[model samples]
Target: MIPIADKYSTFARFYDAMSGEYPVYHAGRNIGISLLRQRPGAQVLDVGCGTGLNFSLLQAQVTQGGTIVGIDRSPEMLVQARRRAERNGWTNIILIQADATALSPAEIGSRIAAEGGRARSDAVLATYALSLMADWETAWANMVSLATPEGSLCVVDMQKPVGLATVLTPLAKAACWLGGSDINAHPWTAVKRDCVDVKAASARGGHLQIRAGTRRAGT
Candidate 1:
């Protein structure tokens, strides 16, 4: 079997085309970003920001005055992200390649500072990304540490379909399997547990779970 990293690297160029963004995943991100409700000039961090799919939506919220720091483990993926940023003439984006679960927050904060962003962002988002990590909780902790005291947090991930959507279970599992994600991971639960005033939404027949909220103090 191809290693996950290699798989991502090899597939980076084709990821957006095969990712089912329009039909399946985009709704979750839309809900998550809408719930985040960031203001103009806000700084945002996107973990596992593959091909910068969230960039356009985030840009709509933060505008040109704001900063966007995108982190992903695959260098090839970062390349695609950078290309997307350049293609749209978005100069406010800072792409970094690193393992989200293992990075040092201080170091990453410093790096962001070097790129003209604040030490901590005003908002943090992860879409269809966390479930790919075996140690997703550690990544979640890092996300918290990289945000401001009351920064907005959003997580969008997948699960088995429910109710009438149960008929799509096999397709959902196939997509998750192709992406090397644990469909049962339920990483958004951490957001619900650790964040306050959490807003929840689901789409695609409950196959997509989205949670957004403010970071609790001292968390």
Candidate 2:
């Protein structure tokens, strides 16, 4: 099930503390930057982006010339994100209020055209957001719709809970309240399966990315 917007609206303030700066978000950002190749400029989208925490890192990778659009359903979260954008003087970045799953190709097409078209975005990203979605299927489908034929897509989510770490249950439960995280016991695995099953398109050819990882870069 997808999480209600209210669930995250309440936790925008303490999200970073809940995430533990060194581990969760930062780690994901590092990996994303490397995968994106830190191109001097690339149009990018951060689907389900929360509080714009990943912006600075992603911007650094894509550079000042790059464009990033961060979308989320919670205004409270987007408020924080806007604050960050102003703080960074990021004129190229735009924030939108919406669910990731609803990011249809038609919507993406219009928005991209309005924002200066040319299929500017080379990357589509989802970091620490999918696990909290109420309808992961729609969200996954929307992501497929948003990316270009050649666009690179990357996602970083918590690994599913392993067999009863009875001792860690309390800690895991606490993490959930902070940002509705860990709602999916097997988030990564489940999403990976969906990705694999999805018939997606790429610049070179039609393809699918599965949780089982049937195909991937440098493979």
Candidate 3:
């Protein structure tokens, strides 16, 4: 079996098209970004930001005045992300290649500062990303370290459908399997556990879980 990183690297160019963005995953992303409520100049971090699928939506929220720092472990994925930014003439994007689970917050913070963004961002987002991590809780901790005390947080990921949608379980599992995600990860629970004023939404028959809220100060 192809390792997840290599699979992503090998298929980086085709990710956006084949990622089921429009048919299934896009709804979760839309709801997640909407819950951000970021200001025009907010500095936002996109963790495990594969191919920058969230860039366009995030840009619409932060605008030209804000900065977007996109971090992903796959250099190949980052290549596509860079291309997306360049194609859109978006100059405020900063891309970093680092393992979210293993990164040093202090070091990465300095890097973001060097790029003219704040050491701690105003908001952080991870969509269909954390579930792919083996130690997603660590990644979630890193995300918290990278955001301000009152920063907004959003996580969107997949699961087996429930209730009437249970019929789609096989399809959902297949999609998660193809993408190398842990269908049972349920990473968004971190938002509910560690955040405040939490808002929740689900799409694609609960196969997609969307959670967004503000990080509890000092948590």
Candidate 4:
């Protein structure tokens, strides 16, 4: 079997078209971005930012003066993300190729700084991406470390559907499996555990979980 990043490199071309964005996954991104509540001129970090799917929503919050740094391990995905930024005439977005779990905070910060972003971001978000990480906790730690003490952190990921949506469990499982994700990952739990004043939401019969909060001191 191919490694996840290598697999995504090939999948990057048709990702936006076939990733179920509109009908399924977009809801989580929308909710997650909303809860971030970033101020104008904020420096935002997007981890595992495949094909820049969160760019539009993040742009609306950060505005022209703000910076949006997008990091992904796959070069092909970064290529698509660059295309998206170019097509939109967005000059404030920076795309970097790096593995979230493997890179240290200093390395990521240095890369961001080299691209004209601040060493620490004002807001950080990961949507539907953490569960794909083999060491998501490390990624989460870097996210926290790369943000200011009181900066916002948001996580959006999938879980088994509940109630009426439970009927779609098989479909959900198949989707997650195809994407190389563990449906039960519940990566947002890290937000609850490490951050304060958490905001939570669910969509698609609880299949998507959104968690956002300010990073607590010493966490």
Candidate 5:
């Protein structure tokens, strides 16, 4: 049998517990909401979505019938996620025990069919999870693979601020390797993708929102 947590399995169970106490949780949800405003009926994919924490926040902003998909590699985390959805009556939520670095349309299609035949999502949202992805670029590409041309790709993550983004980038890189990641890079290494960059309003004491770009026909 495979280890449930490749890099974060152990951390997954305590993720929400740690994040609940995390002061950034509030600002994080706010940024995701703000970035997703332009997309209607947005099919938001919370990549590495831990315990479906962002589902409630996105559920309200997207169209009434909108769906929110949360995918993570840890089954332990998914256990809690099942409870979160059931408790919140978040019928729109679907939690998958999968890897973020491998997210793609084909994979998502299989999962959807297993559920009930839903189409690709309008957008993808990766909160606080990008920094931990095994392959940030491929993960970003995969999320883009799941979005529609008219939809948006919203990313919410923690930053070390002006002096810190640069300083912490390498540290994150090392951590990624030790955590079983060989891609050896952070998602924001370049931000050179064809998409546009929308900077979220700087909340003095909250998470940061970054709208990288709207999905453009198979981007």
Candidate 6:
């Protein structure tokens, strides 16, 4: 069996096409980014940023003056993300290839600064990404560490669908399995616990949970 990173590396070429962006996952992203509330000149971190799917929306908010730091573990995915940035004329993007779970906060902060971004971002977002990390809490802590003291943090991840969408449970499970994610991860619970003034939203019958909030002291 292919390792999870290898799976993503191999699938990078076809990820955007097969990732169900339009009819399904887009809603959570829209809400997550909105909750970030970043300013025009602020810097934002995109953890596990595959193919830069969130770039266009983030660029619109940050404008030409702001910077977007996109970090992913897969080189193949970063290639696609770089291509997307080039094709879209997005010069403010800095792409880093690193494993979020392994890298320390200081190391990543230095890397970001070396790549022309601020050491600490004004906002950080991980969408449909953390559930894949077995040590997702470590990733979440590192994410918060990379943010400014007063920065906003947002997590958008999957869960079992509720209400009418419960009928799609099998499909959801299959998708999560294929994607190497734990459908029961509930990664957003970290944000609720560690952050203040938390905001929450659910979409696609609770299959997607969106949580955003300001970083709390000592978090």
My TM-score estimates for the predictions, one after another, are 0.98, 0.74, 0.98, 0.98, 0.75, 0.98
lDDT of 3 by residue, 1-219 (tens): 899999999999999999999999999999999999999999999998889989999999999999999999999999999999999999999998989888788988988888788899999999999999999999999898888999999999999999999999999999999999999999999999999999999998999999999999789
30 Cα displacement, candidate 5 (Å)? 1.5
Question: Per-residue alpha-carbon lDDT of model 4 for 98-213, expressed as tens digits?
Answer: 99999899999999999889989999999988999989999999999999989999999999999989999999999998889988778999998999999999999999999999
For every model shown, the clashing-pair count is: 0, 12, 0, 0, 1, 0
- Itemize residue pairs with steric clashes in candidate 1: none
Model 6 C-alpha lDDT per residue in residues 1-219, reported as the tens digit of each score: 688899999999999989989889999999999999887988999999999999998998998899999999999999999999999899999999988999999999999999888889999999999999999999999999998898999999999999899999999888899999999989999998989999999999999999999999987
**Pairs clashing in candidate 3?**
none
For model 4, name the residue pairs that clash.
none
Candidate 3, after superposition: displacement of residue 35 in Å?
0.2
Candidate 4 TM-score over all chains jointly: 0.98
Q: How far is candidate 1 from the true structure (C-alpha RMSD, Å)?
A: 0.7
> Between the candidate structures 1 and 2, which one is better when assessed by lDDT?
1
Q: Candidate 4: lDDT of 175?
A: 92
lDDT of each: 0.93, 0.62, 0.94, 0.94, 0.62, 0.94
**Model 6 segments beyond 4 Å from truth?**
none
Cα-lDDT of candidate 3: 0.94
Query: In model 4, which runs have C-alpha deviations exceeding 4 angstroms?
Result: none
Give the TM-score (vs. native) of candidate 2. Answer: 0.74
Instruction: Give the per-residue Cα lDDT of candidate 6 at 129.
Output: 96
